[model samples]
Target chain A: MTDPREAGFVGRRSDGSLIRRPLSPHLQVYDMAQMTSALSIMHRITGVIWSAGTLLLVWWLMAAATGEAAFAAVQWFLGSFLGLLLLFGLTAAGWYHTLAGIRHLMWDAGRGFDLPSVYATGRAVLIGTAVLTVLTWVLLLLFWN
Target chain B: MADGKTVHEAALRTPLGRVRGLGSAKSGTHHWWMQRVTSLALLPLTLWFVISLIGLAGASYAETLAFIGAPVNAVLLLALIAATFHHMAAGLQVVVEDYVRGELRRKGLILLIQGGSALMALASAFAVLRIALAS
Candidate 1:
Protein backbone atom coordinates (compact mmCIF):
# COMPACT_ATOMS: atom_id res chain seq x y z
CA MET A 1 0.00 0.00 0.00
CA THR A 2 3.00 2.22 0.39
CA ASP A 3 5.01 3.67 -2.45
CA PRO A 4 8.30 5.53 -2.44
CA ARG A 5 6.46 8.26 -4.28
CA GLU A 6 4.28 8.70 -1.20
CA ALA A 7 5.46 10.76 1.78
CA GLY A 8 4.84 8.12 4.54
CA PHE A 9 6.42 5.22 2.57
CA VAL A 10 9.62 5.26 4.62
CA GLY A 11 7.75 5.35 7.89
CA ARG A 12 5.76 2.27 6.93
CA ARG A 13 8.94 0.33 6.20
CA SER A 14 10.69 1.50 9.38
CA ASP A 15 9.47 -1.60 11.25
CA GLY A 16 11.50 -3.81 8.78
CA SER A 17 8.42 -5.81 7.80
CA LEU A 18 7.81 -6.89 4.23
CA ILE A 19 5.70 -4.46 2.28
CA ARG A 20 2.07 -5.38 1.56
CA ARG A 21 2.22 -4.32 -2.04
CA PRO A 22 2.02 -6.30 -5.23
CA LEU A 23 5.43 -7.20 -6.56
CA SER A 24 6.82 -8.37 -9.85
CA PRO A 25 9.47 -11.03 -10.29
CA HIS A 26 12.48 -9.10 -9.07
CA LEU A 27 16.13 -9.75 -8.31
CA GLN A 28 15.83 -9.61 -4.50
CA VAL A 29 12.98 -12.13 -4.27
CA TYR A 30 13.01 -14.45 -7.29
CA ASP A 31 16.45 -15.99 -7.54
CA MET A 32 17.15 -17.70 -10.85
CA ALA A 33 19.42 -20.52 -9.67
CA GLN A 34 17.84 -23.41 -11.49
CA MET A 35 18.54 -25.39 -14.63
CA THR A 36 15.56 -23.88 -16.48
CA SER A 37 16.65 -20.37 -15.65
CA ALA A 38 20.20 -21.16 -16.70
CA LEU A 39 19.02 -22.52 -20.02
CA SER A 40 16.71 -19.58 -20.60
CA ILE A 41 19.42 -16.96 -19.96
CA MET A 42 21.92 -18.97 -21.99
CA HIS A 43 19.58 -18.66 -24.93
CA ARG A 44 19.91 -14.89 -24.95
CA ILE A 45 23.65 -15.03 -24.25
CA THR A 46 24.35 -17.47 -27.08
CA GLY A 47 22.12 -15.58 -29.45
CA VAL A 48 24.23 -12.48 -28.81
CA ILE A 49 27.47 -14.41 -29.27
CA TRP A 50 26.71 -15.97 -32.65
CA SER A 51 24.95 -12.88 -33.86
CA ALA A 52 28.18 -10.95 -33.30
CA GLY A 53 30.15 -13.82 -34.78
CA THR A 54 28.31 -13.23 -38.03
CA LEU A 55 30.65 -10.30 -38.53
CA LEU A 56 33.48 -12.80 -38.59
CA LEU A 57 31.62 -14.71 -41.26
CA VAL A 58 31.17 -11.51 -43.19
CA TRP A 59 34.88 -10.80 -42.91
CA TRP A 60 35.73 -14.28 -44.15
CA LEU A 61 33.42 -13.93 -47.12
CA MET A 62 34.75 -10.49 -47.94
CA ALA A 63 38.32 -11.73 -47.74
CA ALA A 64 37.59 -14.62 -50.02
CA ALA A 65 36.16 -12.23 -52.55
CA THR A 66 39.07 -9.80 -52.24
CA GLY A 67 42.08 -11.84 -53.48
CA GLU A 68 44.37 -14.81 -52.83
CA ALA A 69 46.61 -12.90 -50.42
CA ALA A 70 43.63 -11.66 -48.46
CA PHE A 71 42.07 -15.07 -48.27
CA ALA A 72 45.37 -16.62 -47.23
CA ALA A 73 45.74 -14.14 -44.41
CA VAL A 74 42.27 -14.84 -43.10
CA GLN A 75 42.82 -18.57 -43.46
CA TRP A 76 46.07 -18.39 -41.56
CA PHE A 77 44.40 -16.55 -38.71
CA LEU A 78 41.56 -19.06 -38.68
CA GLY A 79 44.05 -21.87 -38.39
CA SER A 80 45.86 -20.28 -35.44
CA PHE A 81 45.20 -21.19 -31.80
CA LEU A 82 43.28 -18.04 -30.94
CA GLY A 83 41.28 -18.23 -34.14
CA LEU A 84 40.46 -21.89 -33.53
CA LEU A 85 39.37 -21.07 -29.99
CA LEU A 86 37.14 -18.30 -31.23
CA LEU A 87 35.67 -20.65 -33.79
CA PHE A 88 35.04 -23.27 -31.10
CA GLY A 89 33.22 -20.79 -28.89
CA LEU A 90 31.20 -19.46 -31.77
CA THR A 91 30.31 -22.98 -32.86
CA ALA A 92 29.10 -23.89 -29.38
CA ALA A 93 27.08 -20.69 -29.08
CA GLY A 94 25.55 -21.16 -32.50
CA TRP A 95 24.59 -24.74 -31.68
CA TYR A 96 23.04 -23.80 -28.36
CA HIS A 97 21.07 -20.94 -29.88
CA THR A 98 19.80 -23.16 -32.69
CA LEU A 99 18.71 -25.91 -30.34
CA ALA A 100 17.07 -23.44 -27.98
CA GLY A 101 15.32 -21.96 -30.99
CA ILE A 102 13.80 -25.35 -31.75
CA ARG A 103 12.59 -25.58 -28.19
CA HIS A 104 11.06 -22.12 -28.55
CA LEU A 105 9.22 -23.23 -31.68
CA MET A 106 7.93 -26.29 -29.86
CA TRP A 107 6.67 -24.08 -27.07
CA ASP A 108 5.01 -21.85 -29.63
CA ALA A 109 2.99 -24.87 -30.72
CA GLY A 110 1.79 -25.38 -27.09
CA ARG A 111 4.07 -28.34 -26.52
CA GLY A 112 6.31 -29.22 -23.53
CA PHE A 113 4.59 -27.13 -20.87
CA ASP A 114 4.71 -29.64 -18.03
CA LEU A 115 7.52 -29.33 -15.51
CA PRO A 116 9.10 -32.70 -16.33
CA SER A 117 8.94 -32.09 -20.06
CA VAL A 118 10.45 -28.63 -19.65
CA TYR A 119 13.46 -30.02 -17.79
CA ALA A 120 13.77 -32.87 -20.25
CA THR A 121 13.74 -30.55 -23.24
CA GLY A 122 16.20 -28.18 -21.62
CA ARG A 123 18.59 -31.05 -21.02
CA ALA A 124 18.06 -32.25 -24.55
CA VAL A 125 18.99 -28.86 -25.98
CA LEU A 126 22.18 -28.72 -23.93
CA ILE A 127 23.24 -32.20 -24.96
CA GLY A 128 22.36 -31.58 -28.58
CA THR A 129 24.39 -28.39 -28.61
CA ALA A 130 27.43 -30.14 -27.17
CA VAL A 131 27.15 -33.09 -29.55
CA LEU A 132 26.73 -30.92 -32.61
CA THR A 133 29.67 -28.71 -31.63
CA VAL A 134 32.02 -31.65 -31.16
CA LEU A 135 30.77 -33.31 -34.31
CA THR A 136 31.43 -30.11 -36.27
CA TRP A 137 35.02 -29.91 -35.07
CA VAL A 138 35.63 -33.57 -35.70
CA LEU A 139 34.29 -33.26 -39.21
CA LEU A 140 36.47 -30.26 -39.84
CA LEU A 141 39.58 -32.00 -38.58
CA LEU A 142 38.94 -35.17 -40.47
CA PHE A 143 37.93 -33.63 -43.77
CA TRP A 144 39.51 -30.21 -43.91
CA ASN A 145 41.90 -29.78 -46.83
CA MET B 1 -4.46 6.44 -0.28
CA ALA B 2 -7.94 5.36 -1.33
CA ASP B 3 -6.77 2.32 -3.29
CA GLY B 4 -9.94 0.26 -2.93
CA LYS B 5 -12.18 -1.80 -5.22
CA THR B 6 -14.07 1.03 -6.83
CA VAL B 7 -11.05 3.24 -7.53
CA HIS B 8 -8.95 0.36 -8.85
CA GLU B 9 -11.75 -0.94 -11.07
CA ALA B 10 -12.41 2.53 -12.46
CA ALA B 11 -8.72 3.13 -13.05
CA LEU B 12 -7.98 -0.18 -14.76
CA ARG B 13 -7.01 0.56 -18.32
CA THR B 14 -7.96 -1.50 -21.35
CA PRO B 15 -5.23 -3.16 -23.40
CA LEU B 16 -5.53 -0.73 -26.28
CA GLY B 17 -5.86 2.23 -23.91
CA ARG B 18 -2.66 1.21 -22.16
CA VAL B 19 -0.86 0.68 -25.45
CA ARG B 20 -1.96 3.79 -27.23
CA GLY B 21 0.55 6.63 -26.68
CA LEU B 22 2.51 4.49 -24.26
CA GLY B 23 5.73 4.69 -26.28
CA SER B 24 4.83 1.74 -28.49
CA ALA B 25 4.80 2.11 -32.26
CA LYS B 26 2.29 -0.77 -32.26
CA SER B 27 4.41 -2.92 -34.59
CA GLY B 28 5.56 -5.28 -31.85
CA THR B 29 3.28 -8.09 -33.04
CA HIS B 30 4.89 -7.90 -36.47
CA HIS B 31 8.33 -7.99 -34.93
CA TRP B 32 7.43 -10.98 -32.77
CA TRP B 33 5.79 -12.82 -35.69
CA MET B 34 8.78 -12.15 -37.93
CA GLN B 35 11.13 -13.45 -35.26
CA ARG B 36 9.33 -16.77 -35.18
CA VAL B 37 9.04 -16.93 -38.95
CA THR B 38 12.73 -16.24 -39.40
CA SER B 39 13.58 -18.81 -36.77
CA LEU B 40 11.50 -21.39 -38.62
CA ALA B 41 13.07 -20.51 -41.95
CA LEU B 42 16.62 -20.77 -40.53
CA LEU B 43 16.27 -24.37 -39.38
CA PRO B 44 16.62 -26.18 -42.72
CA LEU B 45 18.65 -23.44 -44.32
CA THR B 46 21.29 -23.65 -41.60
CA LEU B 47 21.43 -27.44 -41.69
CA TRP B 48 21.84 -27.37 -45.45
CA PHE B 49 24.55 -24.76 -45.24
CA VAL B 50 26.42 -26.71 -42.55
CA ILE B 51 26.35 -29.95 -44.53
CA SER B 52 27.45 -28.06 -47.59
CA LEU B 53 30.34 -26.58 -45.64
CA ILE B 54 31.34 -30.00 -44.41
CA GLY B 55 31.34 -31.25 -48.00
CA LEU B 56 33.48 -28.30 -48.99
CA ALA B 57 35.91 -28.95 -46.12
CA GLY B 58 38.19 -30.96 -48.39
CA ALA B 59 38.52 -28.25 -51.02
CA SER B 60 41.13 -25.68 -51.95
CA TYR B 61 40.42 -21.95 -52.09
CA ALA B 62 39.59 -22.14 -55.75
CA GLU B 63 37.39 -25.15 -55.18
CA THR B 64 35.52 -23.31 -52.44
CA LEU B 65 35.09 -20.34 -54.73
CA ALA B 66 33.87 -22.65 -57.46
CA PHE B 67 31.26 -24.08 -55.09
CA ILE B 68 30.00 -20.65 -54.17
CA GLY B 69 30.10 -19.59 -57.81
CA ALA B 70 27.72 -22.37 -58.74
CA PRO B 71 24.20 -21.10 -59.48
CA VAL B 72 22.38 -23.27 -56.96
CA ASN B 73 24.84 -22.75 -54.11
CA ALA B 74 24.97 -19.01 -54.78
CA VAL B 75 21.22 -18.65 -54.60
CA LEU B 76 21.01 -20.68 -51.41
CA LEU B 77 23.85 -18.68 -49.90
CA LEU B 78 21.98 -15.47 -50.69
CA ALA B 79 18.85 -16.73 -48.98
CA LEU B 80 20.79 -17.81 -45.92
CA ILE B 81 22.42 -14.42 -45.75
CA ALA B 82 19.13 -12.58 -45.95
CA ALA B 83 17.41 -14.75 -43.37
CA THR B 84 20.37 -14.57 -41.00
CA PHE B 85 20.61 -10.76 -40.87
CA HIS B 86 16.88 -10.48 -40.70
CA HIS B 87 16.73 -12.80 -37.70
CA MET B 88 19.76 -11.22 -36.09
CA ALA B 89 18.30 -7.72 -36.25
CA ALA B 90 14.97 -8.81 -34.80
CA GLY B 91 16.55 -10.85 -32.02
CA LEU B 92 18.96 -8.11 -31.04
CA GLN B 93 16.15 -5.58 -30.96
CA VAL B 94 14.35 -7.69 -28.36
CA VAL B 95 17.53 -8.09 -26.34
CA VAL B 96 18.26 -4.38 -26.45
CA GLU B 97 14.76 -3.45 -25.54
CA ASP B 98 14.84 -5.80 -22.61
CA TYR B 99 18.10 -4.66 -21.01
CA VAL B 100 18.99 -1.22 -22.26
CA ARG B 101 17.09 1.14 -19.94
CA GLY B 102 18.08 4.44 -21.43
CA GLU B 103 15.46 5.46 -23.93
CA LEU B 104 17.90 7.36 -26.14
CA ARG B 105 20.45 4.54 -26.14
CA ARG B 106 17.82 1.90 -26.77
CA LYS B 107 16.42 3.74 -29.74
CA GLY B 108 19.94 4.34 -31.04
CA LEU B 109 20.84 0.68 -30.72
CA ILE B 110 17.68 -0.44 -32.49
CA LEU B 111 18.45 1.92 -35.35
CA LEU B 112 22.08 0.83 -35.47
CA ILE B 113 21.17 -2.86 -35.53
CA GLN B 114 18.58 -2.45 -38.26
CA GLY B 115 20.79 -0.19 -40.33
CA GLY B 116 23.88 -2.33 -39.83
CA SER B 117 21.96 -5.47 -40.71
CA ALA B 118 20.82 -3.95 -43.96
CA LEU B 119 24.34 -2.87 -44.94
CA MET B 120 25.89 -6.22 -44.07
CA ALA B 121 23.20 -8.13 -45.91
CA LEU B 122 23.77 -6.00 -48.97
CA ALA B 123 27.54 -6.46 -48.80
CA SER B 124 27.35 -10.22 -48.37
CA ALA B 125 24.90 -10.54 -51.23
CA PHE B 126 27.14 -8.42 -53.44
CA ALA B 127 30.18 -10.48 -52.57
CA VAL B 128 28.35 -13.69 -53.32
CA LEU B 129 27.07 -12.31 -56.64
CA ARG B 130 30.53 -11.10 -57.60
CA ILE B 131 31.99 -14.54 -56.98
CA ALA B 132 29.14 -16.32 -58.74
CA LEU B 133 29.15 -14.04 -61.81
CA ALA B 134 32.88 -13.46 -62.03
CA SER B 135 33.55 -17.18 -62.39
Candidate 2:
Protein backbone atom coordinates (compact mmCIF):
# COMPACT_ATOMS: atom_id res chain seq x y z
CA MET A 1 0.00 0.00 0.00
CA THR A 2 1.11 3.58 -0.78
CA ASP A 3 2.13 5.67 2.24
CA PRO A 4 -0.69 7.98 3.40
CA ARG A 5 1.42 11.16 3.41
CA GLU A 6 2.63 10.50 -0.16
CA ALA A 7 -0.74 9.37 -1.66
CA GLY A 8 -2.07 12.84 -2.54
CA PHE A 9 1.03 14.23 -4.20
CA VAL A 10 1.02 14.28 -8.02
CA GLY A 11 4.68 15.06 -8.30
CA ARG A 12 7.58 16.85 -6.62
CA ARG A 13 9.59 19.92 -7.72
CA SER A 14 12.92 19.57 -9.55
CA ASP A 15 14.60 20.37 -6.21
CA GLY A 16 12.48 17.53 -4.66
CA SER A 17 10.35 19.70 -2.35
CA LEU A 18 6.62 19.04 -1.71
CA ILE A 19 4.52 21.62 -3.56
CA ARG A 20 1.86 23.98 -2.13
CA ARG A 21 0.52 21.91 0.79
CA PRO A 22 -2.68 23.15 2.38
CA LEU A 23 -2.42 24.60 5.90
CA SER A 24 -4.75 22.94 8.43
CA PRO A 25 -7.06 24.32 11.14
CA HIS A 26 -7.68 27.82 9.85
CA LEU A 27 -8.99 30.26 12.53
CA GLN A 28 -11.04 32.38 10.12
CA VAL A 29 -13.47 29.52 9.53
CA TYR A 30 -14.22 28.84 13.19
CA ASP A 31 -17.39 30.15 14.82
CA MET A 32 -17.67 31.54 18.35
CA ALA A 33 -20.17 29.07 19.87
CA GLN A 34 -21.17 30.56 23.21
CA MET A 35 -21.10 33.30 25.83
CA THR A 36 -17.79 32.04 27.13
CA SER A 37 -16.27 32.51 23.70
CA ALA A 38 -17.58 36.06 23.53
CA LEU A 39 -16.19 36.86 26.97
CA SER A 40 -12.83 35.38 26.09
CA ILE A 41 -12.61 37.60 23.01
CA MET A 42 -13.74 40.67 24.92
CA HIS A 43 -11.19 39.99 27.62
CA ARG A 44 -8.43 40.44 25.07
CA ILE A 45 -10.08 43.50 23.53
CA THR A 46 -10.40 45.27 26.88
CA GLY A 47 -6.82 44.44 27.68
CA VAL A 48 -5.57 46.62 24.81
CA ILE A 49 -7.81 49.43 25.97
CA TRP A 50 -6.43 49.11 29.49
CA SER A 51 -2.89 49.25 28.16
CA ALA A 52 -3.59 52.59 26.49
CA GLY A 53 -5.18 53.84 29.69
CA THR A 54 -1.99 53.07 31.59
CA LEU A 55 -0.18 55.66 29.47
CA LEU A 56 -2.74 58.20 30.61
CA LEU A 57 -2.08 57.21 34.21
CA VAL A 58 1.63 57.80 33.70
CA TRP A 59 0.90 61.15 32.11
CA TRP A 60 -1.17 62.17 35.11
CA LEU A 61 1.60 61.19 37.49
CA MET A 62 4.25 63.11 35.56
CA ALA A 63 2.03 66.16 35.35
CA ALA A 64 1.42 66.11 39.08
CA ALA A 65 5.14 66.08 39.62
CA THR A 66 5.70 69.07 37.35
CA GLY A 67 4.77 72.62 38.37
CA GLU A 68 1.42 74.42 37.92
CA ALA A 69 1.45 75.21 34.20
CA ALA A 70 2.33 71.70 33.14
CA PHE A 71 -0.18 70.22 35.55
CA ALA A 72 -2.87 72.57 34.32
CA ALA A 73 -2.35 71.36 30.78
CA VAL A 74 -2.96 67.80 31.89
CA GLN A 75 -6.04 68.89 33.82
CA TRP A 76 -7.44 70.79 30.89
CA PHE A 77 -7.11 67.81 28.60
CA LEU A 78 -8.70 65.47 31.13
CA GLY A 79 -11.60 67.82 31.62
CA SER A 80 -12.23 68.24 27.88
CA PHE A 81 -14.90 66.44 25.85
CA LEU A 82 -12.55 63.96 24.18
CA GLY A 83 -10.77 63.29 27.42
CA LEU A 84 -14.09 62.60 29.10
CA LEU A 85 -14.99 60.10 26.38
CA LEU A 86 -11.68 58.31 26.74
CA LEU A 87 -12.07 58.32 30.50
CA PHE A 88 -15.53 56.80 30.21
CA GLY A 89 -14.28 54.08 27.90
CA LEU A 90 -11.32 53.44 30.16
CA THR A 91 -13.59 53.21 33.19
CA ALA A 92 -15.79 50.66 31.48
CA ALA A 93 -12.79 48.64 30.39
CA GLY A 94 -11.41 48.77 33.91
CA TRP A 95 -14.58 47.39 35.48
CA TYR A 96 -14.95 44.77 32.77
CA HIS A 97 -11.39 43.56 33.16
CA THR A 98 -11.69 43.49 36.95
CA LEU A 99 -14.86 41.43 36.86
CA ALA A 100 -13.46 39.12 34.24
CA GLY A 101 -10.34 38.63 36.27
CA ILE A 102 -12.42 37.51 39.20
CA ARG A 103 -14.33 35.11 37.01
CA HIS A 104 -11.06 33.63 35.80
CA LEU A 105 -9.85 33.28 39.37
CA MET A 106 -12.99 31.37 40.19
CA TRP A 107 -12.39 29.08 37.22
CA ASP A 108 -8.80 28.58 38.30
CA ALA A 109 -10.03 27.44 41.69
CA GLY A 110 -12.21 24.81 39.90
CA ARG A 111 -15.50 26.51 40.67
CA GLY A 112 -18.19 27.75 38.25
CA PHE A 113 -17.23 25.38 35.44
CA ASP A 114 -20.69 23.78 35.20
CA LEU A 115 -22.92 24.96 32.36
CA PRO A 116 -25.65 26.65 34.34
CA SER A 117 -23.32 28.39 36.76
CA VAL A 118 -20.94 29.48 34.01
CA TYR A 119 -23.71 31.04 31.95
CA ALA A 120 -25.24 32.76 34.96
CA THR A 121 -21.93 34.16 36.14
CA GLY A 122 -20.97 35.23 32.64
CA ARG A 123 -24.16 37.25 32.29
CA ALA A 124 -23.65 38.72 35.72
CA VAL A 125 -20.13 39.82 34.81
CA LEU A 126 -21.39 41.57 31.67
CA ILE A 127 -24.12 43.44 33.52
CA GLY A 128 -21.94 44.12 36.53
CA THR A 129 -19.29 45.91 34.48
CA ALA A 130 -21.82 48.36 33.07
CA VAL A 131 -23.40 49.03 36.46
CA LEU A 132 -20.04 49.56 38.11
CA THR A 133 -18.90 51.94 35.37
CA VAL A 134 -21.99 54.10 35.68
CA LEU A 135 -21.84 54.10 39.47
CA THR A 136 -18.20 55.18 39.38
CA TRP A 137 -18.94 58.12 37.13
CA VAL A 138 -21.95 59.07 39.20
CA LEU A 139 -19.87 59.04 42.35
CA LEU A 140 -17.20 61.12 40.69
CA LEU A 141 -19.67 63.74 39.52
CA LEU A 142 -21.42 63.95 42.84
CA PHE A 143 -18.19 64.27 44.80
CA TRP A 144 -16.57 66.65 42.37
CA ASN A 145 -19.54 69.00 42.45
CA MET B 1 24.35 -4.18 17.82
CA ALA B 2 20.88 -2.54 17.79
CA ASP B 3 19.87 -0.63 14.67
CA GLY B 4 20.40 3.12 14.94
CA LYS B 5 17.19 5.01 15.73
CA THR B 6 16.08 7.96 13.59
CA VAL B 7 16.71 11.59 14.58
CA HIS B 8 13.17 11.96 16.02
CA GLU B 9 13.57 8.83 18.13
CA ALA B 10 16.96 10.00 19.34
CA ALA B 11 15.42 13.30 20.46
CA LEU B 12 12.72 11.44 22.38
CA ARG B 13 15.28 9.53 24.42
CA THR B 14 17.08 11.08 27.37
CA PRO B 15 19.55 10.00 30.03
CA LEU B 16 16.75 10.10 32.63
CA GLY B 17 14.08 8.99 30.13
CA ARG B 18 10.38 8.88 31.18
CA VAL B 19 11.11 9.50 34.84
CA ARG B 20 12.80 12.87 34.36
CA GLY B 21 11.16 15.91 35.96
CA LEU B 22 10.88 17.77 32.65
CA GLY B 23 7.37 19.14 32.10
CA SER B 24 5.22 21.56 30.17
CA ALA B 25 5.69 25.30 30.35
CA LYS B 26 5.09 26.29 33.98
CA SER B 27 4.99 30.06 33.44
CA GLY B 28 1.31 30.03 34.39
CA THR B 29 2.35 30.11 38.04
CA HIS B 30 4.41 33.24 37.50
CA HIS B 31 1.55 35.00 35.75
CA TRP B 32 -0.91 34.00 38.44
CA TRP B 33 1.47 35.11 41.16
CA MET B 34 2.16 38.53 39.66
CA GLN B 35 -1.49 39.23 38.96
CA ARG B 36 -2.43 38.57 42.59
CA VAL B 37 0.59 40.45 43.93
CA THR B 38 -0.14 43.49 41.80
CA SER B 39 -3.82 43.42 42.63
CA LEU B 40 -3.00 43.40 46.33
CA ALA B 41 -0.54 46.22 45.98
CA LEU B 42 -2.96 48.26 43.89
CA LEU B 43 -5.79 47.98 46.41
CA PRO B 44 -4.19 50.48 48.77
CA LEU B 45 -2.13 52.32 46.17
CA THR B 46 -5.16 53.03 44.03
CA LEU B 47 -7.10 54.35 47.00
CA TRP B 48 -4.21 56.61 47.93
CA PHE B 49 -3.93 57.80 44.32
CA VAL B 50 -7.60 58.76 44.09
CA ILE B 51 -7.61 60.55 47.41
CA SER B 52 -4.41 62.38 46.56
CA LEU B 53 -5.82 63.48 43.23
CA ILE B 54 -9.03 64.68 44.82
CA GLY B 55 -7.16 66.63 47.48
CA LEU B 56 -4.85 68.24 44.95
CA ALA B 57 -7.59 69.11 42.52
CA GLY B 58 -8.13 72.85 41.99
CA ALA B 59 -5.14 73.70 44.20
CA SER B 60 -2.57 76.20 42.91
CA TYR B 61 0.65 74.88 41.34
CA ALA B 62 2.87 75.98 44.20
CA GLU B 63 0.51 74.51 46.76
CA THR B 64 0.34 71.23 44.87
CA LEU B 65 4.12 71.21 44.65
CA ALA B 66 4.34 71.75 48.37
CA PHE B 67 1.99 68.85 49.00
CA ILE B 68 4.04 66.50 46.87
CA GLY B 69 7.30 67.84 48.24
CA ALA B 70 6.42 66.50 51.66
CA PRO B 71 8.63 63.44 52.29
CA VAL B 72 5.84 61.01 53.05
CA ASN B 73 3.80 62.10 50.04
CA ALA B 74 6.80 61.90 47.75
CA VAL B 75 7.74 58.42 48.90
CA LEU B 76 4.21 57.11 48.56
CA LEU B 77 3.91 58.66 45.12
CA LEU B 78 7.10 56.94 44.01
CA ALA B 79 5.97 53.58 45.32
CA LEU B 80 2.59 53.89 43.66
CA ILE B 81 4.11 54.79 40.31
CA ALA B 82 6.51 51.87 40.39
CA ALA B 83 3.91 49.34 41.37
CA THR B 84 1.30 50.64 38.96
CA PHE B 85 3.65 50.54 35.96
CA HIS B 86 4.89 47.09 36.79
CA HIS B 87 1.33 45.85 37.06
CA MET B 88 0.35 47.54 33.84
CA ALA B 89 3.29 45.96 32.01
CA ALA B 90 2.32 42.48 33.14
CA GLY B 91 -1.29 43.01 32.15
CA LEU B 92 -0.38 44.35 28.72
CA GLN B 93 1.96 41.43 28.05
CA VAL B 94 -0.89 38.97 28.53
CA VAL B 95 -3.07 41.06 26.24
CA VAL B 96 -0.49 41.08 23.50
CA GLU B 97 0.16 37.38 23.70
CA ASP B 98 -3.52 36.53 23.55
CA TYR B 99 -4.41 38.77 20.60
CA VAL B 100 -1.24 38.92 18.61
CA ARG B 101 -0.77 35.52 16.95
CA GLY B 102 2.34 36.03 14.96
CA GLU B 103 5.38 35.29 17.09
CA LEU B 104 7.36 38.36 16.08
CA ARG B 105 4.38 40.65 16.39
CA ARG B 106 3.46 39.35 19.84
CA LYS B 107 7.01 39.66 21.16
CA GLY B 108 7.38 43.12 19.64
CA LEU B 109 4.20 44.39 21.21
CA ILE B 110 5.15 42.99 24.61
CA LEU B 111 8.52 44.70 24.42
CA LEU B 112 6.93 47.99 23.42
CA ILE B 113 4.48 47.89 26.30
CA GLN B 114 7.19 47.06 28.82
CA GLY B 115 9.64 49.63 27.45
CA GLY B 116 6.99 52.37 27.32
CA SER B 117 5.96 51.68 30.91
CA ALA B 118 9.55 51.73 32.06
CA LEU B 119 10.21 55.05 30.33
CA MET B 120 7.10 56.60 31.77
CA ALA B 121 7.93 55.34 35.25
CA LEU B 122 11.44 56.76 35.03
CA ALA B 123 10.23 60.13 33.77
CA SER B 124 7.60 60.38 36.48
CA ALA B 125 10.12 59.46 39.16
CA PHE B 126 12.54 62.10 37.92
CA ALA B 127 9.84 64.76 37.95
CA VAL B 128 8.80 63.72 41.46
CA LEU B 129 12.38 63.96 42.64
CA ARG B 130 12.77 67.40 41.09
CA ILE B 131 9.69 68.72 42.82
CA ALA B 132 10.69 67.17 46.12
CA LEU B 133 14.18 68.73 46.00
CA ALA B 134 13.32 72.11 44.52
CA SER B 135 13.14 75.15 46.87
Residue A107 of candidate 2: its Cα lDDT? Answer: 84
**Interface DockQ of candidate 1:** 0.39
Q: Which parts of model 2 have CA positions greater than 4 angstroms off? A: A1-33, B1-28, B51-76, B99-105, B132-135
lDDT per prediction?
0.81, 0.72
Q: List the candidate 1 regions with Cα displacement exceeding 4 Å.
A: A1-30, B1-24
- CAPRI-wise, candidate 2 is acceptable
Local distance difference test, candidate 1: 0.81
Residue B53's C-alpha lDDT in candidate 1?
A: 76
For model 1, residues A72-95, the per-residue Cα lDDT tens digits are 888788789998899899889989
Retained native contacts per candidate, as fractions?
Answer: 0.46, 0.31
Clashing residue pairs, backbone N/CA/C < 3 A, model 1? none
Best by DockQ: 1
- Candidate 1 C-alpha lDDT tens digits along B28-62: 46877888998988998988888787787646789
Candidate 2 DockQ, CA atoms:
0.26
